[model samples]
Target: MIRQRITATTDPAAVHPGLAEHQSDMIRRCPYLGPSVDRGLTVWSAYDAEPGDQPGLFALLVETAEELRTARRESGPLACRNIAILDPEDSESARKIMQWPAWLARNLYAPVQLMVGRFWTGVELDDSKGRAMMPPPVSFFSLRNAIPSKDGLFLSEKLPEIMAILEQGPGDDGRDVFAEPLGRRVDDPASVYRELKGLFPPPSLATAG
Candidate 1:
């Protein structure tokens, strides 16, 4: 799952200047303006989860935005600036990037499938319609394409090492590691795979002639 955080200026003037102009351009290009525009900066983030669990991400985004809005109302308008918390390749840098985005979209928007391949390599969709719908020249991550490690700790290529870090027992850190609770005990990869199969069933076999 890739997480994104977006921040933008509270001042109306500082909001994306070209956005209003683009609105007119879009109207000219397509007469259908499906929704009313509310002027605010919005941040977003996403995670990989079963389709059933997407509501939680949306809820989190909404709650964060409401909290920030309430804080600004009570204290005063915030300083004009935008910051995004992105995954840093290193531990120390990652910690520094943990701050929340101010305004967030209520909708839990997934990456426009065009961008999904950039992070998720070897991803195969079960549906033919889905494969056909994908944007052309799909980009993906590879060891050769990865950004160089600043800390000289090249764990990115080490899946076992990464998994170990992920599976570290609780009380080590409060950070939510698993998106959903696991039913099977740790070290049980087969059980995990079985559970996943239940959640994400294989495409049915084609009928024999």
Candidate 2:
């Protein structure tokens, strides 16, 4: 099971800029239903952050969903700005960098859909498709690459291939399949692999074959 560690409940006026004045009252009156469905945004600590310096990064995974009809209809990368929360030049800075097109799309055109990666959420999905969709945790080292778009990000990679498979209907069939437990953020990949092996002992040769 997965558990949420944080919640946002501030007035729309105080946080979200898109909420209109008329909607503010309605949003306020509406019960605080909690963060928007735990869309895979989480606090991630760097492998070597010092004590008390936990949660070194704020990660938001964009995942393909059935509800993303407009995104599904599109053939290429959906444009969006990579909002760097920190300085862009610094290696450790959290600044999100959006290429000219993505910046323009977010600032000039309508907002596009982004998908969330389920592996990082620490919640296991019950079905094979959902499980197959999980990517190697190391892949997140390039967080921006997971963002699928045709527009091309300034310095980010788009994930159209990953998205296409995930978007398939439940009854759909294909050669695409994968099986691996979600991995943890650690100092090295070898250590993580070792830990996973212990949790999931290798199947016998007959079973594996």
Candidate 3:
């Protein structure tokens, strides 16, 4: 079984940014285009930060949360941003994350997969497809690739592949996505994972199937 706990709330401004405060905004909040069905944008931090009054990166996550109001309105495809924090314990990942800013500073065409990774959110299936299908909410996946549309974020090595899967429907999503988990199971920070519940995509093909 997985262990989970929520230590209470803290002010957003004071929580440590975790990343060096040099590049980009340490904290960010985008207005909800419309009503939220409970879960809005989920920002995940690795084991290093816990969401509680003690003060850590999660305080910034809490501040990012917005009040869910109003009924849903029909809208076009969403283009939300994904900013995932790496587990400080993984030295390799940590080094890469730290180097990302410097890499971009010199050459805007920096490879994004080397540093930042976004968790799987889920597939969007309209009414005919049976609403939206998702995995157990307590999932934080590692997505490798660059966000082509943003700034100098040209589509790097892994993104075009990822985009193909994203654009394709489930049955046609390709065999790569159906493969088993890439690495050993890493238990996500249960408390925060729970907080962002019901918002993750299926982890494997079996579940997605």
Candidate 4:
């Protein structure tokens, strides 16, 4: 499985190196995610100013690329999973909040699989504005019990379908799932910058230095 975490820190190059090393060591010690595979999971860290913009919130990105490669070498059907760990300090609703408009427009649609963890249970968002107003820690633990069993169709069947939706490439159906305005056109960087400036003003000159 590919498991990852998302963070909102400004400097991933500095923070990720240490965190990745620690996580790698942890995975090496883990019984389930370790022995089943050779080498270890690939780890990557990325930063986005708009999403979960806070330091100390770490995201781990894990992929099954190596396992897939090994499976092909052994002439076996690919069997792996991708999982992303979202820090509770980071908001889940905020992750895809921008996609809400396109989802409503029917220009694009996709399912996101979430492993209910301590982070999910504490989610408290205002239904009216879709804003998270409170921090709920227990919400994460509740998800542990709610997750579908590994033997069930939920993970095998539903997960693949959801992945397909997420895999839709850019320009498919004149839509970019990762696009800020969802289905709308603002393809060029200049246009994107202009749009973003309206929503988020440029950092003051005093703060720039």
Q: What C-alpha root-mean-square deviation, in Å, does candidate 3 show against the real structure?
A: 16.0
RMSD of 2: 17.1
Q: How many backbone clashes does candidate 3 have?
A: 1
- CA lDDT, every prediction? 0.25, 0.24, 0.24, 0.29
lDDT of 2: 0.24
* Each prediction's number of clashing residue pairs: 0, 13, 1, 22
Q: For candidate 1, give the lDDT.
A: 0.25
Per-residue CA lDDT of candidate 4, range 141-173, in tens? 110111223313432442343334334422123
Residue 12 of model 1 has an lDDT of 21
Cα lDDT tens digits for candidate 2, 35-153: 22132221121122212211222112111122232333442232111111212223322112212112211211112223332122112222221222222121111121123233233
The best-first sequence of candidates by TM-score reads 3, 4, 2, 1
Angstrom error at residue 14, model 2 = 2.5
Per-residue lDDT of model 3, residues 1-209, tens digit only: 11222222122112224222211221211123122112332223333322221122322222221110001112212212222332333433333322322221112112111112322222122222234332212212221123234312222233343334333323212122112222233232223332222232323212110
User: Please, what is the TM-score per model?
Assistant: 0.20, 0.23, 0.27, 0.25
lDDT of 4 at 191: 29
Please, what's the RMSD in Å of model 4? 13.6
Candidate with best lDDT: 4
Q: What residue runs in model 3 are displaced by over 4 Å at the alpha carbon?
A: 1-15, 18-153, 170-209
